[model samples]
Target: MAKEQHKTNAMRTLDATGARYEARFFDCPEALSGVEVARRLGIDEDRVFKTLVTEGRSGAHYVFMIPVACELDLKKAAAAAGEKAVAMVRSRDLLPLTGYVHGGCSPIGMKRLFPTAIDETCDLHERIAFSGGRIGCQIEMAPDDLARVIPLSRADLIVL
Candidate 1:
């Protein structure tokens, strides 16, 4: 028998949006960073993205996706988001704000649809991977497809 796959909220959202993706699962009972996740999954770090939740000066929340190995450039992100300044939300507020835990936040299914931006580097790959709204699962799909599922725009959000 094949191992059963857990369908996360992220996956379900993708299905509802008719987005195409391949789910990837790994053993992770504890929270792990995006780079660690890519290493464990044996995928290139550049092709793995991490979801970050930030609050702008106006107190509105925003989401940004960047490559696992890179950091989000606050200045660039703020500029792209048209916010005077932005800072990451506390980890404790993650679940309540996004309906996702620290390591399992996916850009696809958030509690509310916040303005989202993805690093322009994602365009270099035909497909990229992101958390599947769960700690041990991930979803791989074309960047264009992801934009269809989420109201996202791509920009130079990553730090040089």
Candidate 2:
């Protein structure tokens, strides 16, 4: 089971946005991705977002929101966050920093306000879905609206 905090990143995100959303669960593999989620929910791959935490040489951590089908361009991510280089953080560095596990990380409610990045690809749609601080659940809302709600570094972070 995940945390028992009762409040999760998804809940905080929705609350911050004042957006209505629901949670849907499934018997998922430990490592669930947006691709699998889109299939299960019968939604487009572009509509399912993935939450990832990254870091730079400076040891600054960042939370990035992007679609599974799309890749996070390091250069673009750096540019968006006004940094020089951005890369995936080590597994050991993730849990303590984000206060969440890597597999079920969310872009909201972290212990600290790490920089956040949302792929501009999501802007094409009115609503998009992302992990709900758990393995098998997701939350959906308007992309632009979501950006405004969460503290995010908004830009084109997708290379594909």
Candidate 3:
């Protein structure tokens, strides 16, 4: 049997919203891409989402959720966020800005709420997984349930 993982801030927030989710942990000796993580978890890469932080031209912060197998289309992302342009937040700035590290960022809980968007493709899956606020930890739940836990919009944020 797998050991129960401790609750993370993200998990606590999800619980507060009464959203159901499964928290899991996987061995992560090296920082791995979301795709690799999903592969190791024996799940479809499309069902595993990665949380990304980006800064708009106006200096406003934004968050995006996309499948591990796809890349965020900066142009499409900016359009979805109603920004003139946007760029990924520097790795070092992730923790200070969102209170999450590079490999463990979660769209669910951040230091402050930012405008967030998830790839519309998420709707294709009944359940999706994302980092559980820590590297090596993951949380799986319905996309709609995740939306209820946090204000999020679904859009074409991924590169086709």
Candidate 4:
């Protein structure tokens, strides 16, 4: 599959940050999981990250990133975000706020700015992978950029 772009928050955000990256697209099968995404991109499965939407206290939405191999602990995530608890936000709710579909959502240039968290597990890879405003399309960037550049909250989210 070839990369496709029709203008998205992710592209705008990348341009704004001056992060040099090339967009690559894969088959985007029904199972568009991060693990398959990494393999399609010829990278380690752990190097690929996934964006997730969660509801905090009072129905406030939050963004979080974690590796395909690890799981996001709602308990720890709530503590990290200073919320009572967190649960997966419905895909229906994500499109309205982020202006992107579920699999395509990216942390960069979200429609709104909420407290964002990237699992410390991301540091395990020198170059991390994330969705590029589309299910198949992805961008590769330095892990440090997600921290120093993006300035997102970081936590050791993986139980392992």
lDDT of each: 0.90, 0.75, 0.91, 0.78
Best of the two (1, 4) by lDDT: 1
As for TM-score, the candidate ahead, 1 or 4, is: 1
lDDT of 1 by residue, 41-144 (tens): 99999999999999999999999999998998999989988999999999999999999999999988788999999998899999999989889988999999
Candidate 3 residue-wise lDDT, 1-160, digit = tens: 1233577889888877888899889888656999889988899999999999999999999999999989999999999999999999999999999999989999877999999999999999999999998999899999999988889999998877
- Candidate 4 per-residue lDDT, tens place, 51-156, comes to 8889887788888898877888888889888899989888788889887787888887777877789898777777888888877778788877656546687897
- For candidate 2, write residues 13-125 as lDDT tens digits: 66766766655566776866679778988889987888878887687877788888888888888888778898898878777887777667777667787878788777688
RMSD score of candidate 4 (Å): 2.6
lDDT of 2 at 134: 68
- Score candidate 4 by TM-score against the native: 0.88
Off by over 4 Å in 3: 1-5
Model 4 lDDT vs. the true structure?
0.78
Return the candidate ranking by TM-score, descending.
Answer: 1, 3, 4, 2
Superposed on all Cα atoms, model 3 deviates from the true structure by an RMSD in Å of 1.8
> Residue 62 in candidate 2 has what lDDT?
77
* Segments in model 4 whose C-alpha atoms lie over 4 Å from true places: 1-7, 29-31
- Cα-lDDT of candidate 1: 0.90
lDDT of 3: 0.91
